[model samples]
Target: MGRSPCCCHDAGVKKGPWTEEEDKALVEHIQKRGGHVGSWRGLPKAAGLNRCGKSCRLRWTNYLRPDIKRGNFSDDEERLIIALHAGLGNKWATIATHLEGRTDNEIKNYWNTHIRKKLLRMGVDPVTHQQLPPDHHLDGASASLLPEALLWAAAAARLGGLDTGALRQAQLLQHLLHTIGSNNDATNLIANLAAANSVLNSSSRIVPSHLLQDQMNMLSGTNYLQPGYLCNTTSNFTEQDVVQQQLIKDMSPGTSTFEAAGPADQHCNTTAAFAARDVAPAVDMLPVQEFAGLMEPMELQLPNLCSLESDSFWKDLLEDGYRL
Candidate 1:
């Protein structure tokens, strides 16, 4: 491993951190010596300071700079800092953009001291979107204790068991579109979403509606609509049929609405419900031919008698299928 650095590395150089005397000297030197604010690497040499350029620059910018804002932080500023951190995460540079006159270090320190505790008190897990354990305490915990990415997984579980693969593909396509600054990549995203169970079963699958609405909601940008070709096909299905199937599924927990909705939503619950409500049922209920078009064709395969042997014979014959 490499050795650690020390402020006293060089002999005959003013070592250690910048002091009040050194700060005054540097300030006076800059005021009296009228010259350009040279590159950071050359500032120490120009200012007659023995410190490294990085150290000198930091001391000047963070502590001695004229534009530096110092004093107690305000409550509104503190709340803004918390919101920025929650939304954008550990990007101090980006967070600093929202905070006027606040350095990254100062915001970082304030987060560590005050806002972090406030988040804990609000039953909000600062990192994950879950509740923190009541008995467990945070003494030596860092911000990493709450990783934000886990929120995606939690949200995925809530949003009808979203497929991780589909979500990732949708995200990548969105990012690609954003990078190229166009909507051409939207086709692939729509195809992926239409193939998923979530969109096919949603009430919004009705006409002219974007198939990738869910994905767009997740990504926060990119209004990737399903292609007009796909939407045109979906127009064959009506909104009321989709709603009824969803209501049925919501009423019946065990079954999927896909079977009830059929290939087109217009064919199922809407037509059936309407006909049953409007026309009188014959004393003899109508035969299957009345609804033959609405039903899926069933496969009829007769089992061979040879395949239906005694349980004892099959048990012995299928013994190899069992494992230890």
Candidate 2:
């Protein structure tokens, strides 16, 4: 037998947005009952609201609740959304639990209307949170350089014992770089890059890996580094060129260098470097500032290259930056 509906369809119940009078009635009813309305199904009749139980509940939770915060989301909230989304996927209700006074509907709407578009504009796949495919409009060298830069940043992060936040920031920067590289949009790109660079520069402390891993595990409900999760060398540069030119410059002089290889090959090298080096002291660490300095040369060169609009400019930048 089919189950009966919760409310009769022919009850002449009101629907859609609640009126101010309706809000007052609902508020008064709740207040009169000492703020306990009991089951929503019975409360509508008791409160003299000609509305469905579901609609009444939604209105109360989303709008009428005294604790509900209605305003633009702060930067902390935005970052929390991204981090939570990365870990929790599309569990909007679950994500809302971490954010006080924010409803799932509001979170979902904000993500769709604002954050999703921003990530897409930055050349990140909103679904996967990974870099998007190279745009066909990009010059060949430009297309390749962004991916190489990302791979390099990942490598540097792993080598430096940087926090997961640093790694996540690198991923975001990679998205921006990919967008600029593919679309050839230097105007907005430069401004965004400057802002990102400033943020990275202001934070000079090296976060301990174990503490970072613990926090990430707690937030994500998983191990920080699953088996076989290291980043691969995705650049198109030859092995010889990558190894010879891109030696860990920040490491103390006279330390042995390993030829950079695919993720699998480099895992042993990374492990060995960590095991041998005492990175407890901040001086021994490769700061993100040094990495940003490496990118400074590119900033200086972007204006001239962007003005040229020639493939040769991209080719020269890529070749010089990567020492290819």
Candidate 3:
């Protein structure tokens, strides 16, 4: 005899987009529970939904897509999105961290059709975030050769959890300099950065106490620092620096495991080497769940919110799609 079918087949309830009456039931059920309806699977059953857990989840996340701000992108958001894409690459959900209500699909579309062309038009290589070489200067450089600046961007992405494009540009620049730049140039660059920082600090003339407090807050929050800054002289950093170091290490044949030996075995050796040297892991991708919390409207603070009258950018990020 055949075994009993799955619960879904047996249930034989209606499936797909919930009806208005069904929505009422679902909303009522949630309201009764003090507006804290937990678990989509349980929710559907409580509201007499015949749909499966996955369907319910999709409906809520996509259509209901609560806390979703439905508006055109603001200039600041556009800049942030561009900067984030530069730093993070094409990780849309991760990119969405900075733009509330903007879905991954929306951002991906914007990048492919819109933002990318705009950058390229401005002489910025979308992938490298660098300017193209002059027409005559392209003699030695292969058209396909990824820019040296992007190498540092890769290194930065490998070494830091920065956005891929920006990091790639930075990394490429760093590597190229190290490979081709004279010691004097590196020193000069560092000197310039230092000088610029000093001038900015003095000119701003912010209170030292406030500045110190800001620094303290940043160090306490989820701070992203350059790899050089994260180094500790005496500790094995493999566990901590997994994302960044792993990306760089993965690129090399030595770290890429032998075919005969399993990847697990090869990684074991790499891990041991890392432990001995006190080298930490690399930073790369962002977790979606964690990022959602950052973008969630419920958690936004009142003080950081700019007045709607004064700032359209802030307004765009917060407002839902429907006109008020």
Candidate 4:
């Protein structure tokens, strides 16, 4: 049950949270008067409010003000507040002048309740807006307990209830995006990992040689070879298909890392194409089948990562700054 309201005291002044009636009286008085500035002292008496001049001023300036913004702070607003706070050093009233419709008290309360805790969790000194010393920040926490990209992945994983393996992959994917920085090749690589869940789900599906090639390309396209398109094939299972099957069969996660010669094509004698590219740093170096056809990015069936009642699940997550 709710606690009894802190009604008007012996002095006839109300305390605690202001009520609807009080707020209305304060707002109406300010609207009817030219405005409440130096007039704050007289506002309570004229407006039929039992609040003190200070209370009336605070109510009009901080809470009942017509221009005050309400609701959760936006990301831009939060960033701006942080930036302003860094320079102003707890001069919340000064900070209030810069932020549209936000009062000094509200900003101060938000800083105490929310942003300060988040910064501490991330090992940042909220007061200085700088990375805290390793010895001081949250006891044993690192200089940066939460790097932005990794933090985003971790947050998404925890909130979405992703398994440990998937969470690892998400972190790995974020790192790859930063490291590789290639166009279609890098994109295909990530799509491959995202699609791995599907392949893993259907372990008994008897994956086709071509499909295995797709996965291999996804896993390590540059270091490992990808099957080129079949040209003028004679057998139901072409030479390209047979070779790929044998390659997949021979290479497994247990296979030791080793470099292989490039292609054996008519253009550069297939085996003469550049084998010099660095092998992908995947721990499991599954060797790819070296094909004679032109090396092209395999068409992959990218999985629908997540689906929700509304727009695509991934799309919604991204829009919500889950990518942050």
TM-score of each predicted structure versus truth: 0.39, 0.44, 0.38, 0.40
Per residue, candidate 2 scores C-alpha lDDT tens digits across 1-324 of 876567637468887778999999988888888878798888788888888888888888888887889999865467556645654457788668667789999999999998888766655555545455556132233222222233333334433544445444443343333222322113222333444455443454222334333333332431212211111111122122222123233345555432322344345343323212321113333433433543454344433323312333223222322222
Best by lDDT: 2
TM-score of 1: 0.39
Model 1: residue 289 alpha-carbon error in angstroms: 45
lDDT digits (tens) for residues 1-324 of candidate 1: 875454445566665667887898677766665534566566666777787767776677667766568898764466445534544566666566556677777788877786666656544455532334456453343233111122222223323323433333223222222111211234333333333323323342211224245444433332222112111212233232333333344343333322333343223333332222211123243423222211111101112211223333222212211110
lDDT of 3: 0.41
Go through the candidates in order and give each one's C-alpha lDDT: 0.40, 0.48, 0.41, 0.44
Q: Candidate 1: which stretches are off by over 4 Å? A: 1-17, 29-36, 135-324
TM-score of 4: 0.40
RMSD of 2: 18.4
Q: Can you write out model 4's per-residue Cα lDDT over 1-324, one digit (the tens) per residue?
A: 985433333365767788999888888877776563555556677888887777777777887777899998765457556645654557787667666789999999999998788766645577654455556433332222122223333335443544544433343333223222211233344443334323333342222345445544544523211221111011122223322233334344343332332232212211111111221333343322221111121112112211101223222332233433
Candidate 2 clash pair list: none
The predicted structure with the larger lDDT, 3 or 4, is 4
Which model scores highest in TM-score? Answer: 2
- Locate the minimum summed-lDDT window of 10 residues in model 1: 293-302
Instruction: Give the per-residue lDDT digits (tens) of candidate 3, residues 73-96.
Output: 665456456645544567787667
